[model samples]
Structure formats: structure tokens, C-alpha cells
Target: MRVTGLASGIDIDEQVKKMMAAKRVPMDKMSQNKQLLEWRRESYRELNSAIADFRYNKLDKFRLANATNVFSSTVTGNKTAVTAEATLTANQVDMKVRVEKLATQTTATSPALADSTTSKTKLSELGAVGNADGKVILEVSRGTGTPIKLEFSKDDTIQSVLSKINANTDAKLNASFDEASKKLIIKSKDYGADPFTLNGEFDTGIMKTKTPEGNLQIGEPAKVFINGKEHNPAQNEMTINGVKLAFLEESGNEESVITTRPDGNNLIGTIKNFVASYNNLINTLNSKVGEQKYKDFPPLTSEQREKMNEDDIKKWEAKAKSGTLKNDGIINGALLQMRSLLWDTSTKVGNKNLDLSSIGITTGEYTEKGKLYIDEEKLQQAINNNPDEIAAMFGGTKEKDGLFQRMYDRLLTPLTSISNKAGTSRYSADPTLSFNEQSIMGKELTDLNSRMAAFSKKLKTTEDSFYRQFNAMERAINKFNMQSASLANFAGQ
Candidate 1:
């Protein structure tokens, strides 16, 4: 058995609840307005998204879908060779005069012992060179020892040439080679011979070097036009319509820096849009759930009035202050994702682990009372580190969720359900009718329109009765006043 919630003629809880409910009409209206604002925000977000997509795909012709292949290498030995794939826009390119060897080469080694002043050995004797197809025929000089004569078949590799030279002579000669760079320079076995000589010759791939080796290998530099301007990474420079960009090698994990200042104001536009959208959402939530100035409580509804109790109000207030709603799961989740993304990876150039907070996003403890807020400087730092990551955090499909979808469900679903149930139209009586009571397959519109006309007529009748009652009361008051004055005159007579 259950007791009635009412007590005597006045239920304190009910009366207080009625006051609360009366106060809450404003909240209900506020909720609708919030929904309207959210709808507007959504419209703007969609429009911006569409515009961005258009710019990236059609308008902004400078976007990079992919990057050109880059080549990097180093040569270790005196004679080295390197081969890599190449692609060029020009059908025919001038691939000559570019030296195959690196412009600058460096080597590090332990210092020679002080007691032993003997110089390190250097290789000197060099001869016969071959091309891509193996063929050997060349001349050599006997500088260190007796001049030696050697003969080898065309099928022999470059390695074979070195083997024959080492076997036939004791001139303190040594040879080492790297296959990557295709460089075959020789040195003397003695350290004092700073520059060893290679007097060799060959046909096809083999070219004679002017200094000592018969021929040096050189190729043309690769060139490209990016955004209608020439760019050569090997040259470490790019010229975009007379605006030159000198790219220094990336230091540490920092990205190679580039500048396009006057035209780079797009960042400002993007940030403004984000702020507008986020503020719109925040404002909507505030309007709906803000505390009342008079009682320091949020407005309640009719159903809430019926159920209000001291204990219940306290509990519900506690829930509002302490639970997910107060903390705002959507906002908290968005921020968390952003923070997680900022700290996810290391710098590309250097293996330095990073976090948003490191760059500037400083996050503190979050609570249900909406105390947590974004640190703009820290957020900007994180964005500077990785713009793509930040964008994805706010609007990515990784989780298949967003604030719009979540908030819409939370605030709209219950109201929609109530609206459907409270509808007095015949459309609501149909079991097959959807909760919204609007569909091509349903007769809901016809029923609702007819019901609305009847309700309007009844409202007019009630208004007319109120006016007639007011007129009647006015006439009675006037008649009583006139009769009172007549009685006073007769008494005086």
C-alpha cells in the first residue's frame, strides 16, 4: 500500500514543488531556445566543413596529396657506388656534370699511438675501368715499386681488378670499395700519401678522371615545379613565385620550418570558427541548466513538482553537481581526446616524445561543476606540433562519436517523447503513428489539423464567457452604488 503524497489542504512539499514548477517554465522554454541555438551552430559547422572540403579539393590548388620521393645516402670507402630509383616530369633530362660523390665527406678515427710514428697505409696504383657492362682495358703507373704488367678478361668485375693489382705488386697499395655511390677513387697505402692516384680507363660506364682516375661519374640535378615555382630539396631551397624558402635540416624533433606569412592567415580563420562553435555549445548548456537567482536552484518541471521532497531535491541536486551531467561528459571527452592526441607521438625528425602540456596545453583536474577549462596557450602549442591531430580529435571518426550527436540525444529525446505523449490529437491515438506523428504513410496531419481547429473554437468560447462575466459584475456594482445614494437622500428628507 502507498500513502498519498498530499497532506490536509496544504502539502508543504507540493506547494514548494508548485513554486519550483512555476519557476521551471522558463527552463523548459530555455531548453527549446538552446535547441534552436544548437541547430544554428550545427548548420554553421556543416557549412564550414563543406567550405573546407571545397577548398581542399577544388579551390586550394596548393594542397599536397603526396610528396616526391627523397634520396639520402653516404659513401664509406675510397671507391663507392650507390644506385637509386629516379622519376622526373621531363621526358628527357640533362643528367650530366653532377658529381656522383658527395660534396663534402668526413671520417673519424682514433689518433695514432705517439711511440709509433709510422704513417697509415694508402692505396695508389690504379688502372683499367669498366662501364655498366663489365669490360676492362686500361693503363697504370708503377710509382712505389717496379712497374707491373697485368692482363684480365672483360668478364671480370671491378673487384677483380683490385685483386689482380694487390696480388702482383708489393708497392704498399691497398683498395676498398662501396657499391652504392659508384665512386672508385684510389689512395696510397702509406698515410703520408694524402691523395692516392688511380690511372685507369674503360669504355661504356667507365669515364676517365682528369686528376688521376680515368673518368669521374657525375649526373644532373633533379628539378621540380611546386605551386608554379621551382623546388630542389637537394639544393635546400625553394622559390615560390619569387618568394624563396630556405629549408634547413630539421633540428631535433622540430619540423623543417617554412614561411608564407601574408597568405598564411588561414590559421586565424580556423581558430575563430572553432571558438565560435565551442562557445555556442557552452552557452546552450548554461542557459538550460543555470541556477535560479532567487533560490540558488535550477528550475524544476510539473512532474518534478509532484515528486519533490526534501530528501529527493537534495539527492537530485547532488547528482546534478557530482555526476557525469555536471562534469559534462561530452566536453570532458572532447578535451581528453585532444590531450591524448597531443602527447601521442614523438617528433618526426628526432625521436623526442611529446605532450600537449609540453607545448602549452596545461590541463588540471576536471569536476562536474564545470570547473575544467581549456588552456589556450598550451592548446596552441599542441596544435603547432600537429594540426592534423588536433582537427581529428575534435572531428574525427576514430570513435564514431561527437558532441552534437550525444547532446542531441540527451536533451531532445526525452522532450520529444513527452511531446508525443501529451498530444491530444487523434493522430496520437493511432498505434502505428510514429512518436513525432508526422509521416507520408500516416494520416496524422489531417487528424492534428482538425483537432487544432476544435481546440481553438473552445478557447474562443471560454474567452467570451470571461468577458460576459466581467460585464455583469460591473453592472451590479453600479446599481448598488445608485441605490445606496437614494436611501441616504430619503433618510435626510
Candidate 2:
């Protein structure tokens, strides 16, 4: 315990506290600087997240031909027999579809039991004889592949056998027991014409496979005719010429006609969304770079925060966080590149040079900072006149000269630069994941932390020294007072 101010009547403890507070000024500044750096890193990460969302979700899809050239199909005649869907590459022509046969799965059933039994009934009770070791082995085969062998004790219940068969994915089989029919039924999980066989002691005892035809039924492939050309697919669905056709039922002699047409609404909506998202992203970047910094407001120290209410702290922090990304070179450079790319006239749609202006998309006033403005009526006219050109302009051909491709490629530069500086993970979808400590900003934080630690140690030593000096001074004053009292007593004697 410290006993001060008793001898000299000077509040040494308070004086020492005041001295330490002044000594801590540099430490508080370091704290504020560290906090500011953290805020800037957070801001960069937020921008990275926004850019990733735009690149992956919007630009990736918009650059695809399918997204810009959406197609819808309609079935006219025998619609119930077949359904069709068309892709961007599909030919806009009518196709006749006739489904002669629907696909079926291979199935097998055991002969009725001598007595009614539930799944819980023991196999032995159902007359299932086991081997000498009292174990029944069931071998199941699908197609010409190797058979799956399942062994169970005769004492096991029928449910156990069914569960084992159903759980074996490699078997590709499903097994069940019917209580009312007193029979065991099994079938291939896949729809195909492939042969399925069951051969084992259990089959003889429970499945009664002695007369194979009476117990087993083979599956049939789906027989369909597209434009009078026959196709025998193992499944009911087939894709031809980029058009997917799914056979619902046999049409006998009747034929269903599938017609394809361009879907304008979907294409227009996609373009509109792209424009809106582009504007939103650029606006956010612009605001961040142009935001005003409050020079008077620095990050609060712990001591300062302790003295203020929550509302006051929040308002102060708002000013402190403003313009963390002001005039960032990487962000400003990206904005300029994006604006230039959109205005590039070198992109060609066929023989004609195509640009955003050709499709009613143009930049707003200079004050808007490259925000896009779309003329809807003119855009609709352009789409109506030559939708293929519009699709090629946005999605491009194999040449990759389209606007979406250009924008997507341009975005990569900034994204990479930001990730390198801010330590944001480029591969991960999550922005809040731990920063890479080797990044530029991360290294800066590491240095700050090291310096702060060293300074803190030094501050500790200084505080201890101040307390020791005060203690010595107090002792000296106490000794002097004791000597004065002794002299007065001697003189009186």
C-alpha cells in the first residue's frame, strides 16, 4: 500500500496520477492511429465484397449468350405427351415429337408367403432357411456389374434385410415387404431397360425365384421420335440441338409440335438490372472517395469514451470514420477505367461498330460520374429491330469484345489491387474472414502493434520510477520532522 502526503501535506498520489496521464498522451495517439487503420481496412473489405457480388453474380451471367438471348418454347398438339425447353443456341423451328413408350424400371417380387407376416417378423418364421452357420446370404445384381452380397442371420427380422438392401447405394436397389400380400418386392432405383437379377439362398427361400419369369419383370427404355427420327433413351428426358424434351406419356400415333420464340421481357429485364447495379456500385465508390474528412475528430481513446454517453460517442465516431477511403488511387483508377470501357467504340456487332449509345444506353451528365441512363423506348426499338445484335453487343461472340466481358475483365484489376493492399481473400466469398497478415496494410498493423507494445513497457517503467521518487521524498520529509522535534526537546532540557 502507498502512504503519501502524510509528511509534506502535498497530495503526492494525485500529482503522480497527473504526471502519468501526461506521459500516456503518445500511447493514446497510437491507439487512435491503430483504430483509424482498422476502419480503413474494414472499408476496403466492404468494397471488395460489393465488387465480388457484381462480378460473380451479375457480370458472369450477363456475359453469357443464354442470358441475353432467352428463348421460350410452346407445345401445340398432344401437349400432354411431351414438354420442350429451348436454349439460346436452339433453332427457332417447329419440331414434331412423338413418345412411343415411357421408360420403366426393372422390378421383382417374391411369391406369397405361406402365412401373413409383418416386416418385424423373423425370417426364420417366414420359412427362410439359413446356411449351416445359420446365416442367409442374398446376392443382388444390376445390369452386368458385380453382384452385392448381403448376409443376415435367420433370426433377424425382415425389416433388417430391407434396411440393409436400401442402405447399400452401390446396389442401386430398393427392397420392401408387403404385410397384406405377405411378399417381398425389390426394384432397381434407376429407370432403365437393364436386367436385374436376384440369386441366393434367401431368394429361393423367400423370393421363390425357381420360376424366374413369374417373379421378375424387366424394364423398358423410353422410345421417342423427334422430327420422325427415333431415339431410344434409357430415361424419359433427352436434349437435341440445345432443346430439352421430356416425354410425359406415349402419344401413340399423335405428334406434339414444339415452337420456339425469343423472350424479349426477360432479356430487357436483365439489361435493366445490370445497368441499375452498375450505377449503384459506382455511386457507392464515388461517395466513399469524395466524402469529407473531419480533421478535428480523431478516434476516441478508452478514457475519452468513458466520459461520454453512447449517443455522443456514436456521433463522434461517425465523423472519425468519414472519408476513410478518400481519394484512394485504386478506386479512382477503377472508376475512370470503367467509364472509358463503356464509351469505347471499337466493339463491333457484325460489320457495324457498336457502342452503348447504339442501344440507348449512355452516360449521364458529368456530375453523375459515369452513371448510366437508358432510353427505354429506343432500347425496345433496337431489340425489336435486331435482337441478335443486342445479344452479341452484351454477351459477344467467341471473340469476347462484348461490353459485359470488357467490364468484367476491367473489374479484375481493382479487385486484385484492393485484395493485395487490404488483405481481403480473393478466393473466398466471405469478406469478414481473417485478413492475410502478409498483405501491405496487415504489415502496417503488425508494426503498429509492435511499437505500441514497446511503448507500453516503457510507460510502465516511467510510472514505477515516479512512484519511487515520491515515496523517497515522503520518507525524507518524515525524517526531517523527527529531527526537528528531537532538537526542541534537547534545548528545553
Best by TM-score: 2
For all candidates in order, the CA lDDT equals 0.36, 0.84
Clashes of each: 30, 0
Predicted candidate 1: what Cα RMSD to the true structure? 28.1
TM-score of each: 0.23, 0.85
* Candidate 2 lDDT, 409-465, residue by residue in tens: 889899899889989966554786999888999999999999999999999999889
Off by over 4 Å in 1: 1-273, 291-377, 380-493
- When summed lDDT is taken over every stretch of 10 residues in candidate 2, the lowest stretch is 345-354
Worst 10 residues of 1 by lDDT: 63-72
Q: What TM-score does prediction 2 earn? A: 0.85
lDDT of 1 at 307: 82
* Per-residue lDDT of model 1, residues 338-448, tens digit only: 334334522322465444345443334543322224555565555555544443333333444322223222333322322333221221222232323342212344454
